[model samples]
Target: MNDFSKTDRLMERGSAFLGSRYAILCGAMSWVSERHLVSAISNAGGFGVIACGAMTPEQLETEIAATQELTDKPFGVNLITMHPQLFDLIEVCDKAGVSHVVLAGGIPPKGSVEAIKGGQNPAKVICFAPTLALAKKLLRSGADALVIEGMEAGGHIGPVSTSVLAQEMLPELSQDHIIFVAGGIGRGNAMAGYLEMGAAGVQLGTRFACAKESIAHENFKKAFFRANARDAVASVQVDARLPVIPVRALKNKGTEEFTQKQREVAGVLDRNEIAMEEAQLQIEHYWAGALRRAVIDGDVENGSLMAGQSVGMVKEEEPAADIIAKLMTQSEDALTRR
Candidate 1:
């Protein structure tokens, strides 16, 4: 039987978040957190979140159904708030009986939140907030909980790191409002550490990206396996005037290419050769297609391989179940050692 005294604070919080066995959560990752991966994580006793970026409402419905077919356990659908079909996606999720819906990429639009909260079959709405103010705003605007994401997280990140966000927000937010910590969280020990810091649970994205059940391309996973802690750094401008979102990633062909392109674009804008809007559009398009090629086609060298700094810690691919179990074991071990 599992030992309760050996349970770490994070494990206890995670158990409370899930309201059942296990304190692990499979983070919602773009292009990779599909039905199979979500179901795999959930069935293994962790909360799995399906990333619904750029998907049409109809597409989300099919994916949600596919996930349901794979597991009867609770799972969540992650919606990109900036997506044009955000409202429709919420409708689809409501119809699918999705237990939880996480809104990422900016604060959730009020209309979307109202719809989700007011619907006859309303689902729990979870959103990511960068600061305590944002977290308070989300909760006031109908969010059931918040996933406090730090700059160290993969994909689009906020200005603050998870450490600061947690320190700033957790102290103010009431315990009734669930707060899950995200960014640079990979192992069970890390999860326990956050729990001690007052997080209800930890959301992990990068480590799962390399899991055997993950849909991330083989080359993408290989890059993560090859990464070292030193290899993962946030992007910086080549010139003082030009800056981009501080995305943390492994230094590889894709990252280098993106940085070089940013430098060139900044040069053009500084010289008034290109409009700021035009330069921004070009950068956005480049990243859009680049991420698709890397995630969908497995072209790691040219595609945007988004990952968290914790990626350097990932050495190999294992089944989602094994990863979850190992994390729990590690958390237990950490508690005993303490």
Candidate 2:
């Protein structure tokens, strides 16, 4: 059994892994993890990762430089490996001197990993894996660390739940590699709990989405505040197939619309009516524009208001700095009490 009660041991190891005051990482959220939020979290003592979902190389370079100007604190940029501009995004990170680069979405290509870890680009590469096998593969492929994100995470979740993944992957992975756990992590106690469970750090997205400094639309924040655990459920029954990307969100019009669209797309396969390429393109297009409608335009009803189950615990919109401070303080308090 691991001796989790050693505070010094935990802090030293945690800091080495997370490079932050608290072992908490703000998950890279597309459209939401822009300059303000990223800088705010990093300045507040937690690792903030900027999400680079659909940005061109030039855009990513501009964003990385902008984030650096905001704070000298260490921060990271997230890239979806499947994105068409994956190589370009990696080059941007290399040029911008980004301390860390988080690769999310799909299996990272070998060339992409080599580019990130190759000489001259010392940026720590982090990848999200749902299983021990995948984690091992990523580690072997030059990933500096792994983010074991569970199914409870919002926005493109893996097939496995966090509870199961943590239990299964943490023990098998070598201690040399870092492990950050994600999915439904909200409070400081939650962070401490995961650390006790062998997680080097915890990644939080939904909680930060409700922060005052977050760019999410007011209506979107309100929806999170209104949601309870019961209100936050995955859409499994709607699609029970493997490789099902679990999405934990509040039951709303936008979610219903997405489900309906998925069903409609699935039904038209027999007649060769909807090409897989076209269907995927439409879904991607729908989400690409949908989040902006809710986040920027404040149109919650017909927009994608992606949030995790932890949203129920978020009551008010507080400053990002305050949120970070409170979480660290709370985690310390919880650890001391234990």
Candidate 3:
């Protein structure tokens, strides 16, 4: 491996935490982040997280085993906090001896962290904190690290932009805790700025979703190659009371369809056909299914083309190793120029 002294220096804390050569993490994208891409990222010296999106414990176990077969390097598992079988999935990770667990989609429902950390082999718990206060609270709540993703990211996102979240959260928590800044990060210079601001590392989703190793469909990758920043738009909340989190994706018939789906779910919610938790899960399930359609089934026009604003930077298919090397080289060059 080439010496990236400056970049490595800045990434020291995060690298140590993730047990990877670089602090870069591949943001877990449902179908795209399966064994192939995840192992490729880890083999490339960056951390790869398995997206255990809506997967049952048995499935997560099989994925973990498959990923381990591909790479001995460390990686993490991203589990949805709201998954009905959250604890069972945690057990699968525990049995697999996974190193890190990222809890996303909401606050770690009480004891979820404990359950993750309590196994014979404890895993570091990484949580998503959208705000400064929540960052502190998660840190205090036994979270080993935090990823502050902004609205600029693909899929479900918070209201703030990456720049704003970095300025707000990095200085406050980065000194004493491990914090990874994500969202709208497409290049190395942007990464350099965050490291200078005390970010432990960075996470990127859209940038890697179409890597040569990713299993995303050809149509899905083509849509990303053809898209611009403006093409990636966030879905509008059809009803405020439904507790729907806005999703960012490429505009298509599916985008409009989601609004209608939300309305339909809201009607069910209104009629008390399902409880609030069930309603929320219904919406999440919709996204998972839609994403699979685009990523796995090549239904880009009707499936959810979840992408970050960085989609504009993805020019073509490249090996994961080349991608990591390029980003690290660029980051090092930027640091040196400074």
Candidate 4:
């Protein structure tokens, strides 16, 4: 079935705009979404995004060059907003002629959108809209599209569910912002529902994390296959003064240790053993490099197995092309029945 069919009007428009055979965008994952997975996803029809989680501009340039060597299909690069050298990274993306750029991890910094659009051939900028106000602000800031992701997503997530976000943003801003629903999506029927409601498309991460072309360690892929929705737990806010944001991942030895570390820090803060700032920094340091430890080193028990609740829906490792084809078929069946 043609992805650009008129039956699903908004999805077709999204596919055309993204210059992909399908409208699905593979959500970028740190240490996981590298050259192999990104190229495979792009070549397989879905839009692939490279996660620049902690890459310096120089490293980002090298990775972008490597991905280019693998596939000629259009793909996007995801830049974390908090990266200190953000402007420099944008320069690297522009220099590489990257067609699209996604600004993720909290609201984009001021002038971020302009910096992205200022390139010789402006790249389309997509941002995550955590609230309706942020969605409007991103649009006002010149974002070409918005991804409304919810808490069910893996890694850092907002409080709302994907269904609620679609209800709130898609109906109002889908026409203007090209809204793509993310978080907790595992099946085509669910995606079909969102498109019917008004979403231009959808973004998926956990579904693609275990793709055959993904460079994740076998332990990471095995963990995802063995997990269920309930097993994917979100980090808790242990203390108000500590200022720890929740991170969703599979419950593991590392997770338990994180809890104990937070408790130890909280006790030290109470006794004035460390300043609040230092305590917060201590909490932040707990998970640093943990994702890479699991993804690259195969240390699933002690490293972060960041995966969405949709892990329950993943049963095996498959090629990226097969995954995209199955989703399209499922979506078409649902739409035709409707």
- Candidate 2 lDDT over 1-338, as tens digits, reads 22334433554665676577666789877678988899888888788899887788999888888888898888889997767778888888887788788888778976888888773767788898887887888888888888998777788777777888888887777367688889988887877777777777788998899788788878888888888867776755354421235566667788788788777666665457866655655566667687788887888888887777787788899988888777766777788898
Q: Name the better of 1 and 2 by TM-score.
A: 2
In order, candidate lDDTs are 0.78, 0.78, 0.94, 0.88
lDDT (Cα, tens digit) per residue for candidate 4, span 1-338: 45535334658878887998789999999988899999999998889999988788999999999999999999999997867789999999999999999998767888888988998768999999999998997888799988999999998888898888889888789876688999999988888898998888899999999999999999999999899999999988787777776889999998887888888999999999998756865654466578888999999999989889999999999999999887877887788887
Output the better candidate (2/3) by lDDT.
Answer: 3
- Residue 66 of model 4, lDDT score: 98
Put down candidate 1 lDDT per residue, 1-338, tens digits, no spaces.
Answer: 56644554445655665654665667776678999899899888888998887678988999999999999998888887767668888889888888788887676776998888777677888888887777788888888878888887887777788887887887777456678888888777877677776777778888888888888888888888988766677766576565455666666688888888988898788789977656765665666677778887998888888888888779999999888878877777776788
**Candidate number with greatest lDDT:** 3
* Clash count, candidate 1: 0
Give the per-residue lDDT digits (tens) of candidate 3, residues 178-204: 999999999988998899999999999
Model 1 residue 321 CA deviation (Å) reads 1.0
Shift of residue 338 alpha carbon in model 2, Å: 2.3
Q: What C-alpha lDDT does candidate 3 achieve relative to the native structure?
A: 0.94
**What does candidate 4 score on TM?**
0.93
Q: Could you estimate the TM-score for every candidate?
A: 0.87, 0.90, 0.99, 0.93
